[model samples]
Target: MSDSQKPASDPRYPDIRHVAEARRLRSQGALIIDALGGIILCPLDTSRADLRILDSATADGHLLTLIRKQLAHPESAELIGTDIADYPPLDLPENITLEKQDILKPWPEKWEAHFDFVHQRTGLAVTGGMERAVETVRRFIELVKPGGWIQLVDGTLIDHKIAEDDKAWVKLFKVLSQCVTLVGLDTSLGVSTAEILKRAGEGLVRNIGEKQGVSPLGKGASSKELEELGYVELKGMHSGFVTMLKGMPEDKRPTALEQVEGLLPEVLREAQAGECEMRWYAAWGQKI
Candidate 1:
């Protein structure tokens, strides 16, 4: 489908910016350190090397920014950021370049077999189908040079249990998941990464690491800060998702937004109550 034909209210589009910021913070905090260390310890020679990096479905160059700032292989490295629509307004370092392309489509003409590292995060639900999305990712692996790395990070909305069972929060999560699923996407694609990679014929797989934690509610707590930022992002996402649904003949946009608004207070209350927890997963592997 053409970009304009797609609804402006799509949650995938709205969450792009907020998700980028969250990744930026996480990269600077602990994630980047681990990624860099992993790259350094890889079996590749660091000296006299040529590296090309691709950030597939890069929302706002969050991961690219972190890599440019941290990696020492500047001369040998080139970075490309791809997205479905227009690239977000991100200030990238000189080493990075932005390209307007959809991950669902084939790799751009100039990028075939050009990357040494392919990194992507959070696109399973944004793309139209899970298998199609995995196929695109497999094509991304084809674009990488031999003995390269492919890293992916995403989370499922499962197990978002609350101690007190706040109805509002539960309703919101369920509705959000349902809306996205209606478009042929899965919110919980993280659990399937290993299997997808294997299906893509990628070998020498290594389970880098995985992390799980509860999203907090207070400002000082880690998960709380994420929720606060995520709430702000949700306003835009809700508007976008509602707008998309309104375009449908059977969907009612006004009622959707009204329900979303009604749920907000309860979501915020649950956030404050420290009663909810969100689980996340991250992993990486190599192509033989």
Candidate 2:
């Protein structure tokens, strides 16, 4: 359910196997919900009749599933998940539907002001860059009804709390951010979440809210749940790093690959022995 309208061959869109990515998305979704303390923020009234929600970039529809379980009146809600691809888990309740959507493009006119809530997360991989991010948020605003809510979440690479001495772990993340930039995506997506929401909504939304949360990794993990979440995040990032390697020039690719590979063990050790955290930001606004 990642958001990439680009062709599957696009280097920016890592070719992770569906099974692996699905696992990552599920874990990430759980982590986000845990961080936020709920699936729907923005002061939603979930019991409203015919409530509607859209999860953009809804890879594997994991988030929608979570919503379904948590909603006060799940059966009354119109739950929709959209992504570049159309594969939805068969177990999704009848209330939930998955569709193929390229959020970078204009959406259907019928969808304008249609949902009660719109959600997007981890979209820097395909949102192009900072400018495109604003556009994407604007699109999300257009999809919700008047007085409805739109929420955005993303990882703030390098905007995290790590021990000053954890140089190896820090270096690994720096390289990862560089790889994302090399692939033409914005590494600053996370920190820019609030700004993007504000810029995009302009006069269209009100009461914009923003917050940041940490997903602990390795030994910095405060609980077993967070420890596992860290590992899941690390695995997903490693896969993305390898995929980005293919886009590099022949001369640089090998060295970059070796460097990442060599860093894994030491980084893993550091993570398990000490504290590491992935910082994330979420912003939301109610459409006026």
Candidate 3:
């Protein structure tokens, strides 16, 4: 159901799967970050009391927190987080409603043109392939009210900045990309969310916008917080790491896997020491 790694056994690890992802997304969501309410709803009549928002495919509900930032009061919004799995304990569990949903199935009839805003990030992994991902985006746009807002965020799996000599991680990244492709998922789909929505949305969506940024990790990092975030992110990719390695040429798989596994600890150290960077992106639009 996901490409990102699940929670690590370490109790102290933050719920963030990738700090680079959280950073770029939070920055893009700042327009409605303060939760002052009615600001984003400015497009609607001020007297309209109903304001509903949804964060589909949420796991830990971080993006839902960003969506909640726009509400003035708990009751002023109907916030829902939808996923096939159980909702994990959120930072503010009481603030939003959680729903059990399988996006591959048809969207509920009640959800049609129902939300004031819809937010999602790095969610296509749930679709298992690009065609279903495209369908999910189409349904996501359709769920928004006319003149409502929506935002989608995703990241590149192979996007990284490392020392010229850091060919090992780069090689691992290529393997990861191939692994994802062999399974029918687009490794770089996150960078294309805006374009996908723009093309599929056509007359239904307007004011389409997208922006991207690069974040430093490890030894190239300017701060410890960023560095730690990078380390955590790399750790989260471990499962995909294993999967990608196993997908390599059968003859080389065993040796390559062993080599990459041994170097990961140092690779993490490289990020903490300011030696690496990751790229992420976001796309948003208004439902017209």
Choose the strongest candidate by lDDT.
2
Quick one: ranking by lDDT, best first? 2, 3, 1
Model 1 TM-score on a 0 to 1 scale: 0.73
Local accuracy of candidate 3 as per-residue lDDT tens digits, 1-288: 343435322211223244444443343333222211212322433234557888876665666665556455545677888865443354664757777676667888998899887877566654555666778888888888888877776666773433457555565565555555554456577767777777768888888777666666545544555555555556555544664555457664433677667767776666655666566566778888
Give the worst 10-residue stretch by lDDT in candidate 1. 32-41
Q: Model 2 reaches what TM-score against the true structure?
A: 0.88
lDDT of 2 by residue, 1-288 (tens): 453322255555555535666777787777776676666777877767788899998887878887777678888889989887544255788889888788788998989999999998888557767788788888889899998999988886662434556576676787676666666766677788899899999999999998887766756665787678777877777766766676577675533677676776776776687656677788899999
lDDT against true structure, model 2: 0.76
TM-score of 3: 0.73
lDDT of 3 at 229: 56
Taking all chains together, each candidate's TM-score versus the true structure is 0.73, 0.88, 0.73
lDDT minimum window of 10 residues, candidate 3: 30-39
Residue runs of model 2 more than 4 Å from their true location after superposition: 1-7, 85-90, 159-166, 252-255
For 1-288, candidate 1 gives per-residue lDDT tens digits of 543334334445543334444444343323323323332323433343456778776656656766655456765578888766553355667778777676666776677667777777666666555677668667777776666777765555543433345466566666666666666567767666555555654454443434333333323245444546545533443444555455545552323566665666666666567554344444555666
- Which scores greater on TM-score, model 2 or model 3? 2
